[model samples]
Target: MTQPEQVTFPAARADATVDAVVARMRALDAVLPARDGVAVFNRVYLTVTEEIGRRLRGGEFPDPRAATALDVRFAERYLTAVDADAAGLRPPACWRPLFQLRRHPGVRPLQFALAGVNAHIGHDLPLAVVDACRAVGCEPADLEDEFEHVGEILVVLEERVREELMPGPDLLQLADPLTHLVGSWSLDRAREAAWAAARALWALRHRPDVAGEFTDRLDAVAGLAGRMLLTPLGHRTPRPR
Candidate 1:
């Protein structure tokens, strides 16, 4: 007797919250300007925060309060990631961006945070988008424009955050370094980083046994960095607009 044919199951859809957050981020990048990468970071920050709130309300986390904490925690992590990536590059760019970033007294810390966040988030977000697109049988290249849109939103958010949070004498000086950093970055590099981050996250998602371990490690790194860079700032309290 002939053996029956075997069937294969389709890949599972990505988590809805992750998809929603990435989609919104991509949208923000579309309208982002070349000189405004920080804006994209800011929008992603707010979007992620809101999503965490939603997930908490829906009881998606073991401790609902953890969701709220993640909102702020991730924002700082994103910033740190961007800074670390930029620092790793060689000269004549080595530390040039960092030097420029230091020019803004009031806005420097925030800009540093945003840059770090962008570098790190940019590394992974594109990959996630590409994977999702592929899962739906779409070309990853098609998502490039969307990624740029998210970048734009990040710039806008950064500007708005600065305007609201640090409207000090040197506030406008922040724009110069930001413009320089954006101009220095190539889209290709951003795309590559995105691909890496997405694949890493994808791997973590599929391996349930290690997912907690991976997140715990990420949390530990982020926590250590946050304590070093963010805890001293004491600027989490959003200024009234």
Candidate 2:
């Protein structure tokens, strides 16, 4: 399949069922270049969505309704970003760096994947929690277990992705710049920060101004980390398959 110049998801589609989100991701996988930075992350995220869908179908979640709501809401954030980019509007700061640096040849696929992870975990996940809460008419504490379960799965996936994308042992010298760059960000730290941000946002739900300000600050900081993650290494190496 030829790669689409941009992935577009309508607002209506944002509220589509989790199966729809899974199908959308599958379509993206078919169209996007495997080596493209965004595509790299897309593949990882697709895996995650597939797992979530599977669990939902298997009746694994104690509260399937809440889980589905959380899953769909979480997915909509990513789709919204893609739609914004397609329309030439700026996506959230958390996502802008990945979209901007996506095509840079010098950036490794691993860097792109991790940068995407950074943005999603740091910014989108917290907001998704709030979205899910509203959709389910519940509080953050009610969905805490679901949140942690999803996050734990992501952590495992991140480890596997790192192993899969790791450069050859010889290429990973201690002094390599990639080492330092990748080392600077930790997913554990990002997850902790996300939980804190979610609690803060939930507490400020009645105060739009303060909540918006907090979100903007979070976005800016996550974007900065993403920018750092995408720093071109000038390696001239083709992105790993």
Candidate 3:
């Protein structure tokens, strides 16, 4: 698989900022309990959604410059968090069962079960923020494109995490954190959290005024969600076949 291009910033400070976000995410992983992975993922995701809802409903932009900073921070935080998790080898061999389950007869039902949830949390909500930006004569096109780019990055991260961390032996073993987490929920809760965080960041980008505070909070949320996505603790496999 093609790796994402090296993330670079225009200035030294920007690069440092990105690195800091990555560091923070990495730190979070060290402290999280293995058992509470799903719960943590849900909380983070919910927080992201709540933040975005706040901005969308408020319709105010106080500090455009600060908002811009927030946008960059959020983007960096998200990218770094995912990248950091991808760096770790979690489940040790998660792909074997993931591949097997893909062909299962129940896969379609599983996908459908989570489709609405993912759609609202991932696509629709972010798009709404993009629409709001367009309505306000902001550079919606560029921001939307950036959002799409981030999604692409996320897909790559997920694939890598699956390949590296999934259990190879006894793919169905209960001790396999990746398999257990992915197969536990009807639809993976981590996806919801990631989507919610993405949507929230998108919404915050449009406001630009409160971006700083939003970015700080989002950094924490995204970090948690990213861990869930990478680690077996909170992950749910794509619907059963």
Candidate 4:
């Protein structure tokens, strides 16, 4: 349950930069045990953020400024949740499952990683788009190109976990529960849904009441998906005597 000591440049600052978020992830990576579920997710996310940084430097994103803003905002949400959980406060519904199950012995690292991915991509991405739009003085459509590029970078995380974390095709049967769990969610679909949700949220911004309700539902649905993803596939659960 312990997070690392404060990063020199916290991501929560008004003028937060992507570097600050990266630093925070590095700090968490350094302190969290490898087996901890949050740590597993953090490791995957750290790799993803680093890849985005590289892509940004390489001018892969057409709008680097917008991309940076979106990335920073997106990361800040998750870091804030981590801080909240560390402080014994409840995180958003989408994030609650991961935090609650972070230390569960029955869940596999892949489940932890994907469940975190589910919460972040499904819930945080849309809100981050809006926050970034407001910060950058643009609209959600303006950030679509940037969003797509960032998503492509995120796509790598799934590919990586499948290759590195899977029990192997030879050992993992087609009917394996782990296989089904991994198959149940699709990151590409999630990314598309997030984009649509962002657009919908932007359209509903004028009606805060409706928008708030929409976001609440979004959080709940994503949390449900996370709960499903975190289903224990291991034999760690004890049988009745």
lDDT of 2: 0.85
Give the alpha carbon lDDT tens digit for every residue of 35-89 in model 4.
8888899899988888888888888889999999999999998998888877667
Report, for every candidate in turn, its global Cα lDDT versus the true structure: 0.42, 0.85, 0.37, 0.87
For each candidate in turn, the TM-score is 0.34, 0.92, 0.32, 0.92
Off by over 4 Å in 3: 1-16, 33-137, 168-241
Please provide the root mean square deviation of candidate 4 (C-alpha atoms, Å). 3.7
Q: Arrange candidates by lDDT, descending.
A: 4, 2, 1, 3
Candidate with better TM-score, 2 vs 4: 4
Candidate 1 positional error at 18, Å: 7.3
Q: How would the candidate models be sorted by TM-score, starting from the highest?
A: 4, 2, 1, 3
Cα RMSD to the true fold for all candidates: 17.2, 3.2, 15.1, 3.7
lDDT for predicted candidate 1 compared with the true structure: 0.42
Worst 10 residues of 1 by lDDT: 1-10
lDDT by residue for model 2 over 1-241, one digit each (tens)?
A: 1125566655745357888888877877787778878789989999998898898889888898899888888887887787778678889999888888888888988899999999998999999999999989999999998888788889899988878886655554455788778888898899889988999999999999999999999999999999999999877444456
Runs with alpha carbons beyond 4 Å of true place in candidate 4: 1-11, 235-241
Candidate 3 structure quality by residue, lDDT tens digits, 91-122 = 11211122122223433322222222232333
lDDT of 4: 0.87
